[model samples]
Target chain A: MTPPPALPPLLDLTGIAVFALSGALLAAKMRQTIVSVVFFALVTGVGGGSVRDLLIDAPVFWVRDPWVAPVILMIAFITWFTPSRWWEGKMLDWADAVGLAVYSVLGTAKALAYGVAPVPAILMGVITGCVGGIIRDVLAGRPSILMRPELYVTAAALSATMCALGTLAGLPLFTVWAIAAVAGFCLRGAALIWNIELPAYSRDP
Target chain B: MTPPPALPPLLDLTGIAVFALSGALLAAKMRQTIVSVVFFALVTGVGGGSVRDLLIDAPVFWVRDPWVAPVILMIAFITWFTPSRWWEGKMLDWADAVGLAVYSVLGTAKALAYGVAPVPAILMGVITGCVGGIIRDVLAGRPSILMRPELYVTAAALSATMCALGTLAGLPLFTVWAIAAVAGFCLRGAALIWNIELPAYSRDP
Candidate 1:
């Protein structure tokens, strides 16, 4: 199903907006047309959530809600009109980190509400936070998030795990969600500041 | 929802098996471990259908069926054990073309059954035939089907269009499906033999 409708709409929107912006930015960087920018935005904004909804047998979030498409279109328009260099900075990364953190927790919470098992629910969260970017990268034929050794997915997993654990421990929903999001954001931020990376695999056994 | 339950089981399975084999063969070619092979097999086999199901708001086929996972695992094992040279030829291409054709028709039929409009249903058919390989290529960091000028997606689109048109013309379901499948397969087969391709995009206005 969709993210809990009760969550404040602002936080719920952060992920899609940031994801959409990233997709639009990628399209712009490729010198593509407005059509491509909008298409990329729509796909990135909805892809992860759509995948989660399908897995959980819930109606896709965008289909029922009219606002989602319009929001993506607006984001795409802004991206198309703005100079691409305006997006070339650390601020964008920070925004994406915030989105990743909040979305991971939100996805986990929704999965828990739907009676999904804790592990899979946590996975649902990571998938929610990461899949949009992956799809965008694939469509653009760029090196994707998974190919990098960065802390992106790990941060999402951390948030998802924390959300699942906190809920299992009988924590209040708002507190658990806030803490989980912060925890993930902190990890991603630290990675950004320190250039942290996971070790690459080696074939020698 | 899942390709019309009334259809015979063998036809229903042809698409997934061929897709799974392609995924496994790719992994085997890459000299990946059995774990990676199985994962690839599962993802490629179900990826397209899962995407179609999600879009159409239908239950994912493999999630409900116990047989799907085991069959993928079996395919993975067979791929892993076989010598790589065994698959170095045109026969495999023919097999994949069959999968593409049948899956496109099945996907369109399922979407139409779910009350999706004709145009979107046809797109769904193409998506169901192509998304699995696209996802696989992305994960493997390889050149995807979309980058090529070949007639792969076109064949699928032709099948989907024919199926949609046939249904709209009051043709019997079985007749529409069979004819559409054969039409797509023949096109793809001809492409394989004669190297047919669509015109490349040009920058000139």
Candidate 2:
């Protein structure tokens, strides 16, 4: 079998870095030790991709790759020493949006390469983009994003579905990847800017 | 590579059923719908094993096994329709303790069969026994068992560590499995009956 198409390194590293930062930031917020911060960063950075690989019956990606843990550690260190205010702005959200988009698209492409069915492949992509955050939130004892009506998972779903469809239509992998990421990033950015939320279910008492 | 040893079907089924019941009961406590109960049951029943399979690079056991989902569903159905009072006693906890012991032994055995080192194999056992409860607790918005000082995870660790050492010492699988599980179960039972708790960490204010 042909090797799976390699994801763009820039996008992949950026996603990992941002995700590690998010986890470390949460640990910092909780006033945890440096060890906890590093632990959080490692899990958050690799959680989604690890789950994706597991479902596809592949050797876990991080175990084979040497760089992932170190990069996550570096990010955790940076977050640990930095001022909290530096990470508490709209900019961090924008970075996370980009990471979500890129990861979703990459996740879809990898699943398709492994011959997964389209719908499950799309779900894999969403899992790859969103599960790390969910793990982080759960570990921090916060409500998961799925509990909120915000557009986070929806943005991931959009990118994943788009990537799956584009691949099915025989689009070039790089082109489809870029387009899907841009689309997801736009939606997430809009949600951040507009404070958009899905309508909550209500019933007359 | 040699195939992993098969666990006793009765023990396996009991573990799955008890874990599903625990998940469904949590959903019921939260006043969730039947759908949520079923969802919770399936996840909690399979969650630990799924994580173990993933870490071991094994095909996810549930996807291939026909009986797992059906059994979980049956348990969920029983849980949903039963009066809360019917499940309000200590019986469920006892059942869960048995399941935890059996699962920890099985998980360690499987990991060793898959060529994992002993320490990590022991961890896989603990993960297989405990992660489902963690997921169930997180989804129900309750503090996870990990956050408590109970003997729960420690019981799993005991069973897993014993199983690993037994296998290394060339003990018969059946004998080792029984001994390890009984040890764990006895400890857990004592904790439950006596309300044993670990001392909380303290720091000077």
What C-alpha RMSD separates each model from the true structure? Answer: 6.9, 6.7
**Once model 1 is optimally superposed onto the true structure by TM-score, how far is the C-alpha of residue A63 displaced, in angstroms?**
5.8
Best by TM-score: 2
Q: Can you give the lDDT of residue A40 in candidate 2?
A: 69
TM-score of 1: 0.61
lDDT of 2: 0.83
Task: Write candidate 2's Cα lDDT for B7-116 as tens digits.
Answer: 77777888888888888887887899999999999988989998888887888887978898889999999999989888888866876788788889989999888877
> What is each candidate's fraction of native interface contacts (fnat)?
0.13, 0.11
TM-score of 2: 0.62
State interface RMSD in Å for all models.
6.2, 6.5
lDDT string, candidate 2, A74-109, tens digits? 898887777777767665677668778888988888
The total of clashing pairs for model 2 equals: 0
Name model 2 segments beyond 4 Å from true.
A1-42, A55-57, A62-133, A143-205, B199-205
- B180: Cα error in model 2, Å: 2.0
Taken over the whole model, the C-alpha lDDT of each candidate is: 0.82, 0.83
